[model samples]
Target: MRSLITHLAALTPEQLSDLIAARPEALLPPEPATMAELAERLNAAPLIDVALLGLSRPELQIAEALAALGDGCDRAELAAALGVASDDADLDAALVRLGEVAVAWPDGDRLRTVPLGHVWPCPLGLGAPLSALLTEQRADDLRRIARRLGVPAGTQKAVTVRNLSAWLADGANVRKVSTTAPADTQELLHQLAWEGPYLDEPTYRYGRRTGPAQWAVEHGLIHVAAHWGAPLQMPCEVALALRGPDYRLPFDPAPPSAPTRPVDGESVERESASAAATALAGMVNLLEECGRTPVAPLKTGGVGVRELRRLAKTIGDSADHIRLWLELAMATGLLAPTEAGLLPTEEYDTWCDQQPAEQLTELLAGWLSSEGAPLHQPAGTGQPVPALVHTADGAAMPLLRAAVLRVTAGLPPGAAAADAQAVTTLARWRNPMLLDHLDDANGLVEGVWREAQLVGAVAHGAVTDLGRALATDQPEQLATVLDRLLPPAEETVLLQADLTAVVVGTPSRTLTVLLDAAADRETRGGASTWRFTPSSIRRALDAGSSETELLTALRDRAAGARVPQPLEYLISDTARRHGAILVRPVACCLRSDDPVLLKEILHARSLSTLGLALLAPTVVASTAPIAETLTALRNAGYAPVGEHPDGTVAVERPTRQRAVPLPRASDVVTAPLPLPGPYDPGALDELLAELFEDADESHPLSGYLIPTQPGPLATSEPADLARRLLRAAARRTSRR
Candidate 1:
């Protein structure tokens, strides 16, 4: 068969570029001078592993079927092996996907995959041939089996084994032998054929063997090799014949259809914007709370359970919901980690300054690229997988999330939306290989949908116009799309007699800021409700808001609506009660029986730094500390003497101190450590063999192997192969 380099060399420059662009994870160097160099880079083990992980279920299955066939096969032979028609559309598509990633390349009239022996030793779970397996059997035992099956008992052991293998390769002969075996023995053979080709050895004594296992083995149906231990191995040819025409492997390549419910386009758009606004408002509230009283992190790093629960109560959301939001904030750099706790970062200020559309986009983009699932954990491991915390198994989360969103975005325009089941099916079809690594694949997909909904990327199970724009990476169009879908922002609110304010629609930036500071938000949604409580009004006053300024700002926001009497009374009462006490900072007190003496000290310009102020005719206070004030008075040439708080004269004294270094510990000699021995070639070979023996090659990663020339695919004419290659390439380009 032709090498992958030769196959790639046949493509046009543009076609080659498209192929390379399709699989960036291969990490092939830029601009290869020759096809050989490019092919060599593509074949690197790590790069090949990455490419294999990207194949869809059908694509991977087809690749494995090709590998099992050993020598390459033509399209017709491949279709036959997979139990599908040669002209099937999905078959063609799967082949195209494999070809795009250079996993499978076109040979003369066939296709060949990279050498997969080092990876997948047993493709499709088929076992070794009888010829190799019988090496552990006694020659007498083989001759006895040959005689019972009516085969020639050749003197040579190898000759007898080869004849038995050829006889078993034919379906009719195998069926004839199966009819003579006991009913239980026949069932065991059929089970091993489809499920896998290995079975544990029965525990019967060597000379007193019984049961279906021994019957099958005695009939030459299964063989045990000494090197492979006690497990009996079924030859590949026997398993294929027993599988029959139905084909044991799953072969469907069509994308699953999602169940959708129709909704009004206008309603979806409106609800989507409302959800987006609510999300943003919640973020603002969380940040303000954090700024006021930042919670401490756990010793192991991450928010403690109690702290997260407290935040959930403060934010009026579930702990899980709060966790997701915190993760989003952390992911977008809005919330940063510090020694104290998670606090709003400088990026948050910039985010707040952006338009609503841009703000939502920033959050959605962060979610798309974040490393781990915030809600779901690995299968069988009940530990909670926190957001923003990296887990090795979660590396595929971003890719899986993006794939699900892409599928949603690909839906037809209008108010239609896909349910979880349909979305899950298509996502699995698109990334079967990746999903195989995840324990809770369904939960992970559902989590992505929930996260998208949180950020207003989808509404009522459908991708809104805004969501579509975000998923497609059309940031420039987000503002225009969101603007068209949402109603205009209102700059006014309705003031109620119950001391509550209600915003009828999206609030203007200025109105939002004013309400957030002066009133506490009671309910948030399409119309947010704010209540003016005593504490809230006092908080505004403490922030330097005069009663008159606060009233004027409220009336302006209220527009033509009359201000409620209770709200007016509450604001005035709170303002009147504020600052009633006269509190001042004073470090030293100057008391004198003569009023004129204290007056002279307050009027002294040389004592200006002391910040002296006369409280009464006989008492004066200074802002400076006691020592500094006394020194200033003495330097000003005043006959002032320091007095203690108890009315006694104070005296000063000085003492000297020093720190001495401790002596260093003595070092003692110790025996030298033994050196490592030299490497042994035989040991390395044995280790490699053992690793390959135990390796789980049944995984998707083990689906390619080098092909021999003159394989089944070479049966077709070269012209047919060229035509097929062109059609596949055209389809791939159109997809791009």
Candidate 2:
């Protein structure tokens, strides 16, 4: 087979430019002046890795087997190596794709690739060739194999090795020698041939006694390879012959199709919308919690498992469920990291103002491209991968996620496959390079499924309409679908005598805020339940709600039913005792307009921390600082406000802090495989135009663009430009 450079040299200037345009400029040779340099750069390790990303499963399989076969192999030989038919259309297509990517080219009837021996050691788990292993074998063993093969056993070690290598090269000769082995030994040889062409010593107990391994070794069928990952290795030629006419292995050229069951489309929509609403509620709850008190991250820079569990308990949800919401919060910029911990960002307020459908649409967009893998755990480790830790830098999680969504989108509406493995298999087939880490693929696939379900992109294991919109990046379509599927919001609640209230559907923003102020949410889902408690009523009072206003609001939102007596009584009673005991910040001295109010504070035991001492009938003095006094009063259920030196109210605004936004989805390149330059179609043409321009003769770009050396044409003469143009034109005409 001819070298890749020789094949490249035959292409016209336009064809070569098109090929160069297919790759990024960064992957090409720097200032290449000849076809040889271009070939070298294209076949370089990094570029080859990138080119392989465009191949399908069968294409990649053929490439791997061809590289393993060494030198070059005919179509039949290549098919035999992969245990497939030579005339298979998939095989033919795979060869064409290899040529298109410049990973391999056709030479007569054989296919040749770049020298990949260094790139993939032992491709397809096949061992080193018999010729390469000859150097490591014992001299006596070599001579004995030569004598058994009816080849002259030369006295010198090198001569005997040379003679055996020639014999092993011929498939007919290798099969003839295999006839001496017993039937059991032949069976073992065939098994080794298809299954990695090697056997572990411990599994076979080869050197112990008269076994099949021993019989094969004595007949020159298998040999010891101590430096390999396995102990014993069968010669490449012998393995191919043992496979026989219809060489077959476990390789699957086509992707596995998952078995699916049908479901009702309406039911799927209902469930998915419900899940999406639940997910939205969970995120809102998380933001409110973070705003109230910034959560401290672990020493390792992520939320600890214990803290997440505690939050789960507080929110009445499982830890795993909460983890998904937390990740969504991070992904959408609702929450950001701070020096203190993780806090709700300013974006959270705006996000909360949007409708449920709009809110969910934004979340789905972020999730589709999010690098967060909350449900993915390291192998053998009980801990899950954490979010907001920036640990996913350079990882292909976003690419894998899109691939999984693509597979799900292919299923018929309201149809669900049996399990995630089918989706994983299909996804792996489409983007072979993205899921190259075989050990981590399963965990990532499972995590994508869990996240998609939690985000309402999937329901009953089938993709929803909103999910299809998300996958296609149609935001308007996503919003329309969600609005149609999501249940309408209710403006009222069912009040019970037991001081509990229930909303039959999602509550309107106005009613939701009202309930949050006066009641504690006990549970939330499709429907939400709230309990009216003394503490909850007190919270409403503390937030500046008057007793009359609270009562009127409750009455207006009671679903045309009268407010329960027990709930009304609880609220009235709590308001009555709310400010019976008032404490004020005693800045050196405490003064009040009423002498009786001062008297009440002086006698209260809880006010002892204020260190109050009477100075006059309307005044008291304290040794504690003003700030400390104010906190103590507030903690003791007292209404306290600081005063200025002029006796006016002191109003201070709290500082709003924000962290740097997380890496956006757009920032992550979709091609997870190592690709050269961000390809631009015009770069190659621009480069070529500059090469023959009547500009600076010593331009560096000319060296980068021209595949042929610019010898005498280096001058900026008119004839030089015309001549080069004519030459390029001739090359194009010849190709046509």
Candidate 3:
């Protein structure tokens, strides 16, 4: 100890302060030694400086010295001092030991001692026994005492006692004066005292003046000290202890237990869905109510701003909830949005009023019934049907059914008396038998039944009679029913012209004649300027006449009858360009081997020639006769080409190469052909044979044998011949 003191004396002021503070109790001798004797004993040799202290002591030795010093001071204070430079593990151990000492100390109060040369004060005033401070058995007695003093029961007795002691020490009489515990204890006491006052009430009364504090006091969780002037605050130590290790009061009550059985996962989910549906219904109801006028709901006289506000508040859910109900109502056609507001349309309202109650009930039953309820199951499923399951209202089903009926019903006639009777009869039957009646009356009710089917109101074969009756009574409605039940017409007369065209393709020409007569009669009578009405033209076309034929007939009829100019022009224009050009192959291949003859054939005296020209070499050897003609040809600028042997002459090539210039009669007379052979049948036949045999087989005219005719023929005759040839060829191909 003397060596330790000598070492401590050698430390710097900060080091000395730390050493003294760490273990103030250790600074004094346990058996009271004189200060001078202590100093003399500690002063052995020259002391080492604080900086050199670590050089002489090992780590363990230093730690031991520090720990020895700690024993004399308050454990917490010593631990804190040692922890200043200590590692985490050592610091943790020191802190734990300090905590034990703190808890075990009398009154659980913190100890304070002076540094190195000073005296320590006793922390436990009056040196109260530790057992008295922590007396557990006294809790009940303390609670009773608290109740008698008007403090809360289950109050922290230790804290109460501390407060009472403080008041007493302040010179106030504990029994006569009033006092409060610490802030925390006061709150706890208030809560305990006030809690019981309204325990049985349905609703809690909470306010600044009548809140938790007042409630706790009535329930007894706190106590008040008696000293009046000296309000004894609860000691931090005792109040902290009352809080417990878990930080909850031992007397804090648990929440009340639920009354219903726990819901299964499915049931919980269904309940949530039901809640959402009900909320949606409420929103719809509010919207409908807003739409009603004073005359509409006579009982209310008239709704006001207050009513609207109340309605809004009643359905005060998310905007989506309101929107959903509105959409459902619109889709079902129960309500329509108008300029005024959302209102039931006449069809919807009438349907609501007239719908069969039982049918409506069945429909709504499907919507509101919960899956959990046994009654919701079908009858054969072993569960008894509930006599009465809750619904939106008894009337809701009927209204909804009516709405469905109205939406599905086709356009009504002046009145559908038969349909009304049929519906009434169907509605009279109970559910199990209704389907039978409907099946029996299928012919009468097919249309209505089909309409219902479209909206999923009834199953197939369930309401056939109703559907048929609807169809018979309301044909227009049949369109809607048909649209639902059958495919649309595969072919429709999209345009009047298209229909007319079809009519024109008919085998008989009766329609065409009638249309032509109508036009002639109209023109003769001067009924109108136009030769034919669109209807007449259509009729003609539909009568098996093509558009071109119809227009041509109109024009011919008009001209012969001296029709108006506008009418003629209309008919002519319609007919002239109405059809495509017709072309065909011909049998007569009138090939020209002589250049002079080819030119003459191409360019004829009349404008009706149809034969093509070809070049051939002449057998004549003299150049003079041919050159004179050539000069005349070159002056005329006739185009020419090299020719083959066959008594054919090749014309001189012209400056501008073009299709061979067909000869005019003037050219034929001015440039006479130098005939190489006599004008004989055999020669002509031989020429024709050679030309036909030498022609390319692929040419359309190659198969034909040319006639040895001497001159030009009629244009129509040749064209007719071509058409005949084409027909014959087609027939032959078909046979092959």
lDDT of 2 by residue, 552-637 (tens): 99999997757988988888888876654333444666666667877887887987977889888877787788777656666666
Residue pairs that clash (backbone atoms under 3 angstroms), model 1: 1-709, 73-713, 74-713, 115-706, 116-704, 116-705
Ranking by TM-score: 1, 2, 3
Greater lDDT among 1 and 3 belongs to 1
Q: What TM-scores do the predictions have?
A: 0.64, 0.62, 0.14
Error of 1 at 472 (Å): 4.8
Order the numbered candidates by lDDT, best leading: 2, 1, 3
For candidate 1, lDDT tens digit of each residue in 592-674? 66677678878889999888888887778888887787667656645354566776544332221111211110111111110
Ten residues in sequence with the least summed lDDT for candidate 3: 45-54
What's the lDDT for all of these models? 0.66, 0.68, 0.30
> Could you tell me the lDDT of residue 499 within candidate 1?
88
> Best by lDDT, which number?
2
